[model samples]
Target: MLTIDNVSLKGINRPRLSNVGLSLDSGKLIGLIGPNGAGKSSLLKAIAGVEAASGKLLWNRQSLSAMNDNERANTLSYMAQDDTPQWDLTIEDIIDIGLLKKRLSRSERQRRVETTSETLNLSEFTGHSIQRLSRGELQRVLLARALVSEPELLLCDEPTNALDIYHQLNVLQLLKKQSEQGRLVMMAIHDIPQAAEYCDELVLLDKGRLVCHGQPFEVLTKENLAATFGIHADWICNKRGVAWQPRPL
Candidate 1:
């Protein structure tokens, strides 16, 4: 399990995460959802140990603070919201970088990269420079890089931001599959309906505070949506299912 207790960032005047806590187990996909500046990215960074945050983070009974850089790298993989490659490396090379910390035979590393590339539809562009790819392509490549690492805990920030509708669904399905394979996959996402459809759980944050969290049906209440997103849509539940359409203010 991944446990976070009283997690708060210190550098800022106010707490970026407040005294927040969460305990998540493997084989689960958690989606972090909120408006802009809601600390979604900050929370993801804290969980990835990339930001300076005061918290007790434990993964499978091991304290995160006690783990070395390599140890952390071996256990978790983080995908930044802005993952543009500066050096114009090839798709294969960027994917291979995910395994740099791992001790693997050259053939095994190649195998992993190739398999991940195929999974993300990057096989055809394996030798192409990242600079030559479009934004959506780059996003897929970056995700492939993160997925290739095979981390026990995967933290991704707005991973499907630049992708089209099809790719967005594909990525969400992939994350769901990863969790089903006994890995913990948490992503910061903005697409509420997609999150509602796919995530096992949803964590809603606002202004660095954890607003609400639970199953989609329980947490996405009309009042909660109004307070959190100013969404005054009519929420109707029928024999078919629940559905909501936004209304103009």
Candidate 2:
């Protein structure tokens, strides 16, 4: 389980997050939804140990601050909003680098790379340079890289930003699969319907404060959506009587 205790971030005396507290259990897909500049990305960064903030981030009852760099890196994988690769390296090479400094045999590393590539439908583009790939393809490559490490917790920021509907669903399905397999998957999302469809729990934020944190039906209501997003929408049940679809506000 991941426990965030009164986590707050301040920049030059301004607070980005204010006394935030939340807990995430394994085998759950948690979506963080909020308007622009609501500190969704900041919250993910703090949980991933990539940002300095006050308060406690604990993993399994142990303080995350106590974990060394390698320990933290090994346990959590963070995929940033802008996951573009800067190096002039092939996709295969980029995926291979996710293993860190581990001394795996050449064949073992190749196997892992191949498996990850196949899982994310990047097997054909493994030889292509990252700089040459399109935005959606690049996102998939980065996701493959993150999965190659097989961390206990997966943190993604706006993961579906550049993908079309097909790949968007694909990525969400992948996250759901990982969560079902007992990995904690948390992502900051901008699309309300996507979060409603795929997430097991929703953490709604407004101006760096948590507005609601619960199941999708409980948190993604019309009132909350209007209050946080400043839009009115009708929340309707799907044909199967599960999940929600929001009409224009």
Candidate 3:
């Protein structure tokens, strides 16, 4: 389990996060939903040890702040919203970087890279430079790097921002599978209906505070849609799937 107690981050004008608290469990896919500047990325960074926030983040009863760099890297993997490679590294090189800290032998490393590449549909682009691929392909490469290690906790920010509709759903399904395998997968995604359908729980944030946290039906109510997203919408859930239909304004 991940325990977040009174986590807060300072900003130049106002606070980025204020006393945000949540107790998340493993084997669940959690969606971090919020509007722009709602501190969704900040909260993920705090939990991933990328941002210096004042709070107690305990991973499975152990404090994340006390863990060293290598220790934290082994425990969790973070995928940023904007991960552009400066150098034109090949897809194989980029994916191999995820296993740099692992003590796996040569054959094991190759096995991991091959498996991850195939899973993300990147096997054909092994030797291709990242600069030559499309935005969506690059996004998959970044996701492959995050998944190659198979960390216990995965934190991703806007992971599907650059993907097509098909790839977006495919990746979300993959994330759901990751959680089903006993890993905690938390992602900041903009697709409300998809998040509602796939995620086991949703953590809603607004104005740097946690508005609500629960199942999709509980958190994505009419009031929350209006207050957080400034819209009037009706949430529909049935055998087909989940959808938030926006009413005519």
Candidate 4:
């Protein structure tokens, strides 16, 4: 389990995150949902140990702040909201960067890269330069980078921002699969209905505070929707899982 205790970040004029606490478990896909400045990115950065915050981010009772760079890299993988490649490297080259910290042989590294590439359906573009790929394709490559390492905890910030509908669903299903395989997956997602459908738990944030965290049916209520998102929404459960419909207020 990951325990976040009183996690707060000081902003220029206000707190980016304020006394946020959550205990997230493995084997579940959790969605962090909120408006534009809801502190979703800040919280993910804090938990990833990239942004310093005043609180304890403990994984399995171990404090993340105390872990060294290598240890932290091995323990968790972080995918930023927007990552622009500095070098126009090949897809395989970029994916292989995730394995740099591991003590794997050349053959093992190649095998892992091949496996991850196939998983993300990027095998055909393995030799292609990432600079030439579309935004959606680049998103998949970044996600593949975060997944090739196979860390215990995965933190993704808006992993599907630039993807088409098919790729968005594909990525969410892959994240769900990762959680089902005993990895803790927490992603900042913008699609409310997708979050309601795929995530086992939802963390609702508004104005830098955690509004609620629970199952989708429990957290995405009509009241919460109106309060946080400033809209009227409803959810229904049927054969296709939870479906959310939004109505203008």
CA displacement after TM-score superposition, residue 53 of candidate 2 (Å) = 0.6
The TM-score of candidate 4 is 0.97
The candidate, 2 or 3, that scores higher on TM-score is 3
Measured with C-alpha atoms, the lDDT of residue 66 in candidate 3 is 97
Instruction: List model 4 lDDT by residue over 1-249, tens digit each.
Output: 999999999888889999999999999999999988999999999999888999899999999999998898899999998888889899999999999898899999999999999998898896899988999899999999999999999999999999998888889999999999999999999988889889999999998999999998888888888998888976677887666778778
Candidates in order have lDDT scores of 0.87, 0.87, 0.92, 0.93
Worst 10 residues of 2 by lDDT: 239-248
TM-score of each: 0.94, 0.94, 0.97, 0.97
Over the stretch 177-248, how does candidate 3's per-residue lDDT look in tens digits?
Answer: 999999999999888999899999999999899999999889998888888998888778799988878864
Backbone clash pairs for candidate 3 read none
* Candidate 1 residue-wise lDDT, 135-179, digit = tens: 999999999989998999999999999899899989998999999
Instruction: Give lDDT: candidate 4, residue 182.
Output: 99
Candidate 2 residues 1-249, lDDT tens each?
A: 999999998755467798999999999999999989888999998988788989999999988889997888788888888876679999999988788855679899999999989988888886898999999889988888778888899999988889998989899999999999999999999888778888999999888888999999899778998898877776666665344444456
